[model samples]
Target chain A: MSHIIKPILYSYWRSSCSWRVRIALNLKEIPYDIKPVSLIKSGGEQHSNEFRDINPMEQVPAMHIDGVTLVESLSIMYYLEETRPQRPLLPPDFIKRAKVREICEVIASGIQPLQNLTVLIHVGEEKKNEWAKHWINRGFRAVEKLLSSSAGKYCVGDEITLADCCLIPQVFNARRFHVDLRPFPIILRIDRELENHPCFRSAHPSNQPDCPPEAIK
Target chain B: MSHIIKPILYSYWRSSCSWRVRIALNLKEIPYDIKPVSLIKSGGEQHSNEFRDINPMEQVPAMHIDGVTLVESLSIMYYLEETRPQRPLLPPDFIKRAKVREICEVIASGIQPLQNLTVLIHVGEEKKNEWAKHWINRGFRAVEKLLSSSAGKYCVGDEITLADCCLIPQVFNARRFHVDLRPFPIILRIDRELENHPCFRSAHPSNQPDCPPEAIK
Candidate 1:
């Protein structure tokens, strides 16, 4: 909150993890620059020596902010919340805050990693879709149940918390991979409401500077 | 750190996630009762409606603390740190704290999910070991590099931080799945140092009340 230099985000257009970071920056009204690290081009630019130096994990949504480079999407979000506390991503009440995080972890660790690009490559072309659908549906089943008890126009109450940052991108991934959405009415309602919100709309993959012509939706 | 009720932790003996929660509780010196939710036995206790009511995700490492149940291992740890600030699990400086979280996220989102029980079940019997080994090795490559830069007596310098909570369990999982540790000298070094530490030693699965006889390592 004290720096004059703009933050630099190493992100890829289609990455769900990168999308979470984009949503956070937008919601907090932080000014930043995006340094696209193509996860698919040139044998995955994230694997290049230059990018690896920035993020050894070769993952997207790494940020150069607060005078240091931070990797991992969740960690970046936490740093932003800790340092820039004006527009709080977590609710003020301790219980509500934990509820928000429960949903975030449901998507961040439980859902996204299983259907990730690296896992898809490992599962091979023959089983990737099946693998992706199984994990997404399993994760969504849990998300739906969690939301059933917590929802008040959003994933957890009416506030646009950090959980929404994880949920929208994951739902996007779920639909892209052809997972059935009809089974999850609560998730759909939240996703639809957020789709029209300015913060989430600006962070949507299609609106990003690096979004490919073919990916426009 | 005000409380009169004893917390309840729903955990499974060998779950790396359960292990992470156990360590945090011990490190913070918070007294909590363990309610074992066997991942095996009758097609997994986590899938039961009773457990689902407790944690919609139906995963182990759900905690009943601060008058509400919290799921997701990382979220539980965060709650513990926020509520019980004494003997902090994270460093005081913002940058150092981010480093600790970066390492934790590497294991939580990057490593642990790919080798989870549900993922192994889907990968099938024949390829399960191969799948586990491949992901662990890949994750360790990044973890080792990060530890080499930031580690001292522990994963993030001499102080015990949240990163150690993730690293010790992940290394336990890596060894259980037969992922060789020879290549990761820094990880192995930290693992060895923590092995004798009281917090980690007491939290080992074999030391848990519900650990089965065959799993007594």
Candidate 2:
């Protein structure tokens, strides 16, 4: 076995994608350092040439671990599951594992992308909030319906899988856009449950080192 | 061992996400049937209650395999990798597998979602093309840079991986939006090469049963 080193995550306090990774790392009891890349400082620091070299997509949370740099939040989460299989974020059954990933992709690809910083900036100020709410609500509707059949006190089941990591961060984003949570009671319930979970709490944006004082809730 | 049933893929010919799964099924040599879901017919058939039940997200490329239904192209792809294993779409090395998924997520989440049919409709006819071109360009710039270090005969290496399944369809969408391909030579070359490969050729939108006659290249 290769000697393991502490992972270093390149993240921003308010990025929901970064929060997903933080939750996963904490759940696995992995100790990792954070390098905050302010997305809004004098234009996005993610656009810097140096940061671009780390993740050509110029997104987070990227991580350096096991002698390699990895980018894309879902990819990083999967990598951790593969390398650090002790805490097991994915279910053992093939079908159940796919379902967990299905929820992750819905939020990661379907909902989150449309409301991300890059897309919102292009949406322009006048329509940004409306645009974010529209997509988030659309995605949450689907999630609520999926959870109707899939949930067992958490997104996929009673156990906290990677889906919970994905769900908590997305719910946090939905709240940021002031989306009506009543319509997604299942998601709201799951989020409420996860928010108090030690791993999720430790990884919350409010607790991140880079969170501005006023933004901490 | 339980007998495997031929999978049934719910797909829309021009849907890049659906096309990604189609390519994977083809590359895996898995004989599967296609159930067409028209994304543009009188609103979307995906919104119908029956279809929504299959995938509450109302997205195409949902597959019925191994006696259970699966949704989300990447999830379906991963499930296939776990079950089918033959004609693998992921590399054996953990880091290489993570890189392949990183490229897939970059295109799948970062680029495709921003320009999907649903988002384009909201973008409106006036700015839709410009909107698609902008996101596609930004994402292609990142994919192009990542390919500089990762490419051989395909997106990850000489043997095709899930990344190529994603890259080809996104390139197809890029062409549809009239984005110039000159700046992304590696992508263009890999695409040109893959377009002729039998698996990709079979899965091309033009050859699909639902492909409108006029849309065929």
Candidate 3:
């Protein structure tokens, strides 16, 4: 029931949010096409009128699937889970489900928004980078505390829930910003484990259709 | 079982995130104690070593319950739901639960973090207010679109899920920033409706123990 019309994702290679959706789609084994919204060059293509038609907020990582357009990377991922529940991204139990949401919320809500490129641009380049590092470190420290109790092989119990999917991309961004992750050994350990997984590996920035040659590193 | 021991919430009146937890506690009819962590004066009391011992992040809105100390407002809320499942803040079905989570995620992950006072401060005073308004508008717009389809009496399925608990504080922040919410009729409608409700009304910043009288309005 899931394989009919191909999905189209408006994305950018270096975008952590877009990277999250890409990973979710790949993990679900859902086929999709990519439409790159270059963040650099020409003052951000996402602000263009054509892109705004797809997403009023003019953000990257908007998804068009089954004649429906969904923005917000988390929403797109959830929509995919709803439309394609075969390979579930969430847990089965109510408590576990809430826990997964909590973990994702910590990264998605509590951390990512504080450190995104757009927010950094508004804050000024030097302070923006510092803000990103400060919040990312704060978030990672909290995640380390959480993982200390909750992690086994992945972020939740043993399985890879949406929490891990959200974590990797955020940690990727934190590393790119030169935020030292040494204080978050548990988080770093879980990230190391997931980085090698086929689903996560396939969704790496280098693997994205529009990734630049220099971005592969 | 519910009346055994009242929850203890370490919070501040003007903190929008703290307001969120306060509303959730009130809505659940969970009686609790409030320990104020003033964000201003005394150079932001949350930075004290004493408070930092309670929450490593030194953030307000931490909850201590059943011998567990929980940081992160969303995590604390979820913890309450787990500990007291009688009046569920989540949906009954997996799909519905995911949908509720999607709404919460949009505001929590997409909007709230961007406009947080701490983040604004990092951006500095010159552009701080502008930064707050920009992210608030961006988040509210996405919320408006998402709520337009799902709302009946609330953000999803006419029930007061965690989404509403999240929505009220965000709307309050938006109004505080003068985001011109007229464009978001659905959000405004729900905001108006919730604003009058006892749970939201009582949790207003003005009503909090720490909020100054002059700052209440």
**Best-fitting candidate, measured by lDDT?**
2
Q: Model 1: clashing residue pairs?
A: none
lDDT of 3 at A46: 86
Please compute and give the TM-score of the first chain of candidate 1 against the native first chain: 0.98
Tell me the interface RMSD of every candidate, in Å: 0.9, 0.7, 3.7
**lDDT digits (tens) for residues B77-140 of candidate 2:** 9999999999999999988999899999999899999999888889999999999999999999
Q: Residues B122-185, candidate 3, lDDT per residue (tens digit)?
A: 6688887787888888877777877776688988887888999989888888888888988889
Best by DockQ: 2
TM-score of chain A of each: 0.98, 0.98, 0.96
Q: Tell me the TM-score of each prediction against the true structure.
A: 0.97, 0.98, 0.84
lDDT of 3 at A129: 76
The DockQ value obtained for model 3 is 0.38
lDDT of 2 by residue, A72-136 (tens): 99999999999889899999988889989999999999999999998889899999999999999
Candidate 3 displacement at residue A71 in angstroms: 2.9
**Candidate number that wins on lDDT, 1 or 2:** 2
Question: RMSD of each candidate?
Answer: 1.4, 1.2, 3.4
lDDT of 1 by residue, A1-217 (tens): 5467999999888899999989999999999999988889978998889888888888797888877889999889988998889789999887788889888888989999999897898789998999899989989999998898889988888888999999999999998999999999999999999998898998888998899999897
lDDT of 2 at A192: 84
